[model samples]
Structures are given as C-alpha cells and as structure tokens.
Target: MTSKYMALPKGMSESSFDAAIEKFKKALGAENVMIKDEQVRPYTKVMMAVPTEEHTPSAVITATTVEQVQAVVKICNEHKVPVWTISTGRNFGYGSAAPGRRGQVVLDLRKMNKIIHVDPELCTALVEPGVTYQMLYDYLEENKIPLMLSFSAPSAIAGPLGNTMDRGVGYTPYGEHFMMQCGMEVVMANGDVLRTGMGGVKGDKAWQVFKWGYGPTLDGMFTQANYGICTKMGFWLMPKPPVFKPLEIQFDEDSDISDIVEFIRPLRISQVIPNSVVIAGVLWEASTCNTRRADYTTEPGHTPDAILKQIQKDKHLGAWNVYAALYGTKEQVDVNFKIVQDALKQLGKGRLITEEMAGDTQPFKYRAQLMSGVPNLQEFGLYNWRGGGGSMWFAPVTQARGSECDKQKSLAKKILNKHGLDYVGEFIVGWRDMHHVIDVLYDRSSEEETKRANACFAELLDEFEKEGYAVYRVNTAFQERVAQSYGKVKRDVERKIKRALDPNGILAPGKSGIDI
Candidate 1:
C-alpha cells in the first residue's frame, strides 16, 4: 500500500519493509497502518533524559480486535520485524508509547477499549488493553455502582492493563495491580491466544473468580517481559466501605525518616493500616503545588537549599510527608486512627492533618483523592518542576526497615545532589517491602543537563547495585544497564524464556533488556 518506507525496520530494505507492512495493512486495513513519518510522531514522545530519535517508531498498527492482533504478530514474525505494544500510549515518565527499539512498529490497542464485563456481585471486571482507569471509574459512577478502583497517581489516563502489566502500584489496599488481577488473555508472538487462570477452560463461569488453574500458573511470565501481548485482563475491584478516613503525618526533621518506616511496618503488616503508606519528601509534595523551580529561583541549575526551605515554609509542608487512609466501618476507622495517631506521635514533631483540615489543596488533597478511587492528573506536575520536559523514575526496592530506608535516602540524596540534581522522590510502603521511587527530573533542552542526568542515572545503578539495592522497575532508556544489576544467572534465565517464547524476537526486542 505505501509506495515508500522511509523508516524501515532493522536490516530491512524499502521494498521488504513495505511488503511486510502491506501484509499488516491487509490484516487490518490501509487506514489502520501508520507508516508516514508524520503519522508515527505521536509514538516518539519520550520523557526520559535521552535522545528522542532512538525511540521513534517506524510505523504503528492500530489493531481493533484480537484476531487482528494475531494476524499482525504473524506478519511481524514472518518478516523478522520487531514489534512494540502500547495499551493506551499514555505511559508517561517511562517511555510513553515509544517502541523499545527503533524501526519497530507500535501495536496501538487504544481502539480496542471495551469494558467487556463487570460483575458487581463478584467485584470483578474483564477489560481490554485499551480500557483506562478513568473510563472504568466513569462507568461505575454513571451506573451508580458502589465500587472503588485502586489506580496509580496518573489515574485519569493510565490504563489498569498497562499498569498491572508493568507491576505499577497505587495508594489503596488493592495497591498491587498485578496481584489484584485474576485473569489475562495474551496474544503470543507466534500468533496464538492463551488464557491464564480459569479462563483456559471453556464456558468456565469461575474464570474471573479463580486466579490459578489446575496446573502450574502461567500469568506471572507475561508481566514486565517481552513474552506476549496482553489483549484483555480481569482485575478485582474494591467494594466501597461505609467509612473512609484519610490521614497525613508530616515530619519536620530529616532524622525522622529513620523512624517513619519502622513505625509504619507493624501497622502495615498487621493490616491496621491496610493501604500502602506514601512517604514523600518535601520536594515531591512541593511540586504538586509549586509549578516550576524559577518560582523560587532564577538559577539554571538545581534550586538552592535556602529557596527550597523557604518553599517548605511558605507552602506549610514538612521535611517529609506521610499519607495513608483508614477504610471500613465508622467504629473501625476511629480505633485505627487513634492507633496510627498514637504511634506516629512518638516522633514528637509531626502535625497530623485530618480530612477536615485539608481542603482543596495538595499533596493532601490529591493523595486523598487517589485513596478514594477518584482519578486526577495531579502527578503530572513533576515534569513541570525543571521545565525541560525530562523525567526518569529510579525505583529501588528494599526491606521494610528504618535502617534500610535511612541508608537508601541518604545515599540517593547524596548521589543526586552531587550530580547537581534535586531528590524528588517518595517511598510507597508495601506489606513487606518498601519501594523507594526517585524521579530524576532534568532539563532535556540543555545538552549539558541531559548529559548529567544520564551519567547520574548510570552511577545510581552502579552504586546502588554495589549496596545490594536493585531497582524494581525502570524506563526503557536504561533497561539494558538496569538488567545487568540483577546479575547474569537471572539474565540468562530471562533470555532463555524469551528465546523459547518468541524465537523470532518480533515482540518488544529490548523490553526490560530481555532479548536473544
């Protein structure tokens, strides 16, 4: 169909690339096949501090059906062409919708946004890849259904399918997205459909209720890997409780972080604090209210300490901010709130802000909204902090201990400040683990700044790995480097699985750095 193939796939000539895409177009349609340079620009937007050219997609194939996806994968396998997949293409701060490798076609599943089923009695919903959190939330509201949705910070546009596939976290009891999922429908690289959990059996009414089938479960293999393209997934939704209490514990001193995690661990593990506790540094909370660094200073580099302190003072925030909520009956909330208040009071410094105290402001307002299943775009303000449109989330997982949190905070802060960048990060306390997430935000427009950001990121990986701290998730730009931090034996096993599942390497060649 196209007389030209300007951006051919790797090792492909104009004629060959055109022929492959023509076959893809036939499976869907010429209108759905995006090959023009201008047509694929939307898929090239990368928020990471790297050159945008490397992330540009050669073409984009918008598949509206599972059968169409199977046909497209077959075409890619036959032509030895790499393929990248994006659910809604709204995965900001990671890579957006860009393909992992250049010249690979993006299989956009946004058009297949179908809320196939929502069983209120079972609190389960089967959704296609294109079904976004906002879409699902609106459906519940329009139908006047009494259910809550646990979603990431950027909940308005990000989809549950993509977030769960990437193992993204949220702020509710159902915070672990993947664990909340009970089923998945994936389109394999060889053009075959496989259903995990109870979906494997035909006419199985318990497909959405039972997570594991009769044999060895196969759902974990598809997550955060290049193994398959998930077309549909079933996620468990939270039933609305009678009482909801959002709590905030703001500490004044840096030394207080040494006790924050330790104090919260028991409460979190015991289920007294059911939701994931969000421990945010002052800068993270500040960005939600303050738009740019120049609002406090005119310096082209990192904001001065004095200015940051002034921002904290002026904004009425603390050195660190902790947000979590108590949900259940009214009597249950009162008892848990008193326990949380008494334990957190041991620090003898923080000011506990109740829901009544916080009005229409952030980070309290936004955190409260997310905990209640209300979707908002408040987290997008992080990109506006430096004003250069660059951000990379450096997330490292550690044990839920005070010493570990202190060590990670100290090391990360020193490294970040040494690189002339500020530490805009937070810690989401899971049941047994703490995810220390750092946003390496920088000015992409400045070549010098981008260079520093890249070096800072590389050093972080190197130094953290030496300390036995490994990032749980990373953007596409540093997947290769981050992959090595886990060691070779693990990498070898991943590569073996990739080779076995996708021999042609046609599906996301360098995703999480798993390739032949």
Candidate 2:
C-alpha cells in the first residue's frame, strides 16, 4: 500500500512530516498549505529523462507576504525540512514547478505576485516573484506606459524575478535579464530579510535605478542558489522605440553556420545589431512553426538529412535561420538595417527576409515578436517536434566565433544523431558569446526511446566536456553532474556558503548541487 503522500524528505519520520505540515498550514493559512497527493501532483511534473516520482514534492506552501515567507523559512529550519522555492513555477524544459530533488516541500511564490512599482519616466519597475511578463505587459498597456519588455519565449507565464534569478536571456537590447536588474529583496534561510543594492538604504530613491550599492553586490549571490528565496526584484525596461524592423537571414546549408557567425559577430559586437540575435537551426525553426516529426519520416532513428533538406525546400526555410532586429528612429532603423544588409551581403548567400515578406509566416513571426519585446508562447512548439511530452534544454555557452560555433554544432549533432535523436538547437548570439541551446526531445511513452534519450544526454555532457564545453544550466535530474563540471574548488566554496547560511540545509538541499 502507498503511504499518504508520494515522498518525504530523507531521514524524516512520518509524524515529524505531519507536524511540519501542520505548522506550515498554520503559518500560510489552510488554503495555502497543500498536502494531498493530487494537490501536489502538478508541482512534481518533470520533463527530464527521469520519472516524475524522482522530483515529486512532499507538499506545497503558498506565501503571499514576506512575513509569511519568513515564518515558513523559520519552521523549515526548526524542523530541518528543506523547501524548494519557485517564483511562478513555469520553468519549462528546466524542471517546471518541480523541486531540484524529490521530497522537498515546494515554496510556491506565485501568490506573492505583485507589481510593486513602475516608473514610466525612468523606465524601471519593482516587481514581486509572481509578476509574469504578460502581467507587466498588460499593466503597461492599460496604463498607456510606453515601455518594451524583453522576456523569454514563454513570457506569457514566466515571471521576471524567476527568469532574472535564473539568468535567463531574452531577445532585446536589455536581453541579459540579470544585468538589467538593479535591486532585489530576498528572504534568507535564517528567516532574515536581506535587500541587495540600493534596497538596503532606508528610503532609498534609486532602489530600482541603481544596480550596485557601495558594498559587495549580493544580488547575484541569491541567483541560482538555495541560500535565499527572492521575494522582489527591480529591473530596467526598454523604452518603446519609434521604429522597429525585424529581419531574418536564411542560409541554405548546415555547413554555412561558420560563415553566419563570422559575419554577424562584428555587427553584434559593434552594437549595429542591438537585440540578442538568434541563429536557429532548421528543425528548431520548423518546430516553432508547428512542424511535427510525423510530417516527415518517423522511422525510429534521426530524420534523414535528405528529408531535412526537403522540409527546408517545402517550407521555404533555411538550414540556418538568423533572426535579429533594428530599433531606433525611422532614419536610424533604415541606416542600421542597411548595415545589417551589407553584413549579410558579406556571406554572399544569406537570403534576407523582411517582416513584410514573412507576412505572419510562423517562426519568423514569433521570432520578430520576441525581438520587438512582445511576449508569446509560440516557442512551446518545440514539444510538438517529437510529441513525447519530454524535453530537456542542453544549453552550453561558447565564444561567438564562426569556428567555435561550427565545432560545437558538429559535436552536438554527432552525439545526438549517434543516439538516434535529432539535433534541434539554436545559437542565441550575445555581445561576444553564444548560448547554444538544444532541446533534447524524445518520446517518453516509449521505454526504448526514453532509455536512449537518457543515455544521449549523459553522453552529450561527457563528450562536450571532453571538448572543453560545459552546460550553463541543467534540469533537476542532472544538477549534481553539471555542478561537477565547475570543478571541486567552486563546489567547496558553495558548500561552505551553504553551511554558513543554511546550517540545517532547510532551503533546497540539492539545488545547484549545494547542501549543508
């Protein structure tokens, strides 16, 4: 017979767990504390190569105020109960809603969502963890504030606080979410409230405008760590430009990746292309446009290159699709667009497709929307590529050099194809770096495919590391392995910090593989 719950924290007695749940209910109100298996099931849903049971949360606690969060942390410390904190719990492909490991109570902060303040004049905002991109966008629109929001593709559901804390990038001038952040309000594991940057100063006027206060900047420390739960964040917003022009340069062959990066790097570094340029593979583009594996040959192994070529031909797509935009006044956009056109001309073969030519044609439409600071869920089409309800983001950072990108793409494709999976990936071009994001898609319903996907992810990690490459982030199942990639010294330092701040390890014991 199954116990009353799916799982509990290791070494904790059932009676102790019950007592902790009682205390949590008392602190968060009965409606906020959820313990039933069904009520907690949604938080445990994971899309990794592992079973959902592996990441199942023991219970869920929703906190609407910092005082409630402090109380929860105190109780967790008191009972030595670890809690996994999530802002909106919309972290898809990176363990959405699930804890870093099994049995940790989920501290649901979606209820704390509040757009605390917005200064249209200064183009800054102070928001709680639950304020989603769509929420802020709506707020700006309803109030007639002329501001642009740069958010991840899943902007409709994901929040700024969570995305910034995770260091997620978007497709705009202020795409580097963390860098755009000015301040933060975090609840430490010891039940203390810590404000970073200008938030610490009493009646500080520049809390949302200044990122670095006098002392050591602690805003970054709380990110991607279990040391604290972030309740509020402050960040800058791009003022709506007078004119926006989105463009796509399509390259015919897979080998053209090298030339694509070579030509684009200079323009990006020089700020001619101000937005985060995305060089998406054909499959990635196709997937975003609702193309499914079933549309092509589905004969088990990787889709044949011949079929891929045919899809490109039929859909009027390029093997390597480059997406970026020009924003400024009419004259400025025209000049920048001409400069971009001149750069693409250097490639000698990039087919430039403008917004008018795209004409609501998928991928490009959504991509343009993203580059223009519009929130959309169209990128979720990646799941329909394999139709297995399984996906893991295998992201690795690399220099924005032609040869480096080519090498990484070749290596990734070789590894993925060797395991009979397709290489559906993209290179998000930054100022001087590329965030090579690959969605490792598989059909979890098939035991064989699931096994292959798991093995493929591990081998991808191993082989990529051998080539001096490591992932920037990973799903819950592989946090420990990814942590090892940073080396032992860093791990030791993190452990020391965890011990110092969270002696009882009550806040997400396995988060980023750090624990007391």
Candidate 3:
C-alpha cells in the first residue's frame, strides 16, 4: 500500500530516495519523519481546482528546533530533493500544507511552538514559527498584559509568523502584518542561520523594536519567495486603547459601492479612520449567518439578483456592508464617531449601525470582534455557503479610486456569472490602495463543476492581466502563470538570486517560477 502511493523526487530512483528518507529519519528522530500513505495524505490535500496528486509530497519531516531544520536542509541538498516549507500549514485558500510541485519533501515547522519573549513596556514580541494568534492572545491575557493583537479573520488557528511572512492583513490599525515585522531568524539553504535587521548584533537589545539595520535590508526577499525558511520572528504589538468603538454602515444599492469607496478614501488617507476598513458584499456578509446556497435555490448557475435581494432582506443585510473601528481616548472616539455619523447621514444611502444597535448579531458581531483585536473563527462559515469545501481567493491590488473599484467589481461579476458561480467578495481599504479579495467558491465534488471552476479561474487571470490588473497572491496551481505577468526581466533576476542562494535547487523549485 505504501509503495502504491510513493512519489519519488525527479532524477531520484526508489533505492536512492529510500536512502535519503533514512537520513532524514536519523537527523530528526524516527518518529518525526512521515512517509506512510496515510501520514502523507493530509499534506497533499489542496482546496484549489487542480488535482491533488500534482502537489503530493514524497515525505514529511517535522522539525522541533532550528538545528533540526538545518539538518533537514543539508540532507535535501545532498540528495537533490526539493523541500517546501510551511509554518503552521493552515494557509487555507492558499495551498495549505502542500508542496509547489510533485514529489518534494514537506518541511513542517509547526512543532517549533514557542513564545521566546514579550516585553510589556516596549510592546514587542519574539516568537517561534508556531506561536499562533490565539496562543499569544491567551498569553497576554493570562499575564495581564495591556497589548492588543491584530490578525486575519481566521485568527484562532492562524499564526503571526506565517501570516506576516505571507503579507496577510488584519482589521486593526496595524493591519499590515509584514510592515509591523521588525526582525527574523532564517535558516538558509546552506544550513546557516542568518538573522535580519538588528538581530545580527551581539547582545542586541532592540531587535524587536528597531526594523532597519546598518546595511541593506533582506527581510522583504524572504516573503513570497523560496530563498530561506524563517524559524523565529520579532514584531511590534499595539497597546490597548482607552476606548474602542466598532461601527458598520449599510448601503442598500449595489450601485452605491462607488460612492461608498469615494467617501471612505479621504477618511482613510487622512487617518480619520485608523483601522483597515472592510466593505463586504451581500453574499459575503450573508454567508456569516450560516446561509447556504441550497436555502435560496438549488439551481446550478449563479443565484439570481432577485434571490440575492431576498436574502439581503431576510437577513437584514445591505447590498454592501462597511465595517470600521475607532480607537483612542473617550474624547477622541466621541469626536470621530460624530464625524462618521454625520458623513454617512449626508451620504443619504447608508444606515449606520453601532455596537449598541448591532448587539450580538452575526456577521457584525464577528466583524466587530476582529476590529477590536479579538480572535474568532466566524469567517470560516464561508466554506458552507457553496457546500463542497472549495475556495480560492482572487486578490487584486487597486487604487483607492471609486471608478477603479467599480470597474473591477463589474468585470469580476461578469466572469463569475458566466461560469455559473457566485461573486463572494470584499474590498479591504488601505490608505492609498485596496486589496480587492474575491473568494471563487465552487463545488469540487462534481466533476463538471470542478472543470468549470478551473476554466473560470484561468479566464479571470487572463482577462484581468489584459486590463493591467494582477493578483497579489495565488495558490500553487497558478503561481507559475501569475509570475509571468510581472515580466521576463524580473523573472530572470529572481532565478539568478535563487541560483546564487540555492545552487542545487533543493528549495521549492516551482515557487514563483524561480528555480536554478
């Protein structure tokens, strides 16, 4: 049975691959290495439209310490086996626990769960790869620390190190995860540990407080790249505010999306809205209330606008829901609240909902939880909306202009409706940009639907590129295609760097299409 599912690395015979596995088992302990069919099955599970066999791993090596990671890298280099590294393996819509290509080893770093240090005065923390948001939150709460945490919606299970390295965002003022990162300890391809930023200095006191070192900064290179495996990281923490006010604005018309963005852009740019604001669509907000597609219609195609309007009415949801929060002293929040309320009233189409009005209501409750720096898994309800456990996040960066957002929404909806799928999307507003995130939900159980989903995703990539819009991140199935959109010169330069750092191509070879 094990032999039936065995997938050896390219250019490696069965016997040679067996020898490499033995070395891996000896380096990390026999129990830490997994090569059985059942043990390796979970590593190959992917939610993308592609086949799972395409991302199968030859084996899984769990590392508990930085030294063990170095040992695994050395063995892979010697055997010419490619290795794909994952921090907690909970990257959900983005290739969770899977390799970039077939037959590469999976370097699972989840066993390295340790919170190295947390300074209450400096509001800084040094943590291992597996220190999850919930874990850190519990630590701060237990110790009576006054620091707050900002994390992605799946904050209960997701870790900061992986999300920060992947450049994910949260709903708090410090939503840009990577921008808050100060330093990191990475395990290089050559089995050496390189510390970034102020960490390189002996007896460094400000490693987690200072971001820049004396020379060139290398922290940005490791993100979204396969240059090194980050073992430990340091980042800043936001201090708890004197008062927190989470609010929502509901717009009745789908056409009001442009006007809504136009109004919010100035507020965000001027720092009047201190948190990362979320403008979610009707379907996206409805999904949070446990509403399923089967409830409204059993039809195979996209749900009609009539039924969508009905759902919005039944759930008391707007065509678009805007969520943002204000933090600071009581006086500061009072002044900002008045400004927000007056502006929305002047806009005429929006109905403002404060914490008092939205008490314990779903969707709003979860959104409020996130903006207030609490951990919750309420957003996971999105998986049940389509009901086949298929989700792909098609995220594109756009200017914070009203016209640009309207154009993107129209194009995305047209393409999705053409493929018999619903458009469950949102716009996460930044100071000068918007992360337009659209979850391409489908039923993977049906062969026909799976094929259609694959085609739909491809068409989205092609059409968006022609319009000069590109996705910020994609799953393993489309990484190579998305990398081409950047141009040949950038691709060539990335390859040169990959070769210089990892000559044997032992790291993730197909990652961003940059391999030696």
Clashing pairs in 1: none
Error of 2 at 418 (Å): 0.9
Q: How close is every model to the real structure, measured as TM-score?
A: 0.98, 0.99, 0.99
Per-model C-alpha lDDT, please?
0.89, 0.90, 0.91
Residue pairs whose backbone atoms clash in candidate 2: none
Between prediction 1 and prediction 3, the one with superior lDDT is 3
Overall local distance difference test of candidate 3:
0.91
Q: Candidate 1 lDDT, tens digit per residue, 1-516?
A: 553543568888877887887798789999999888788888888988788888888888899999999999888988898999999877677788998877888999999999999998899999999999999999999998888999999899999999999999999999998889999999999988999988889899888899998899999888889899999999999999999999888887777897888888999999999999999988898887755787877766566778877877988888889999999999999999889888867756678999899877777988999999999999888877887888889999999999999999989988888888988989999999999999999988889999999889988988889999999889899899888888899999999999898999998999999997
lDDT for each residue of candidate 2 in 1-516, tens digit (9 for 90 to 100): 566777888788788999999998888889998888789988988888898888998888899999999999999988989899998988888999998878889999998878999999999999999899999999999999999999998789999999989899999999999899988888998888999988889988988888888878888888888899899899999999999989998999999999999898899999999989999999998988889999988698899999999989988899999999999999998888888877667668989999999898888888888987778999998899999788999999999999999999999999999999999999999999999999999998888898899999999999899888999888878989999999999999999999999999888888888877
Which regions of candidate 2 are displaced past 4 Å?
A: none
Return the TM-score for candidate 2, rounded to 2 decimals. 0.99
The model with the greater TM-score, 1 or 2, is 2
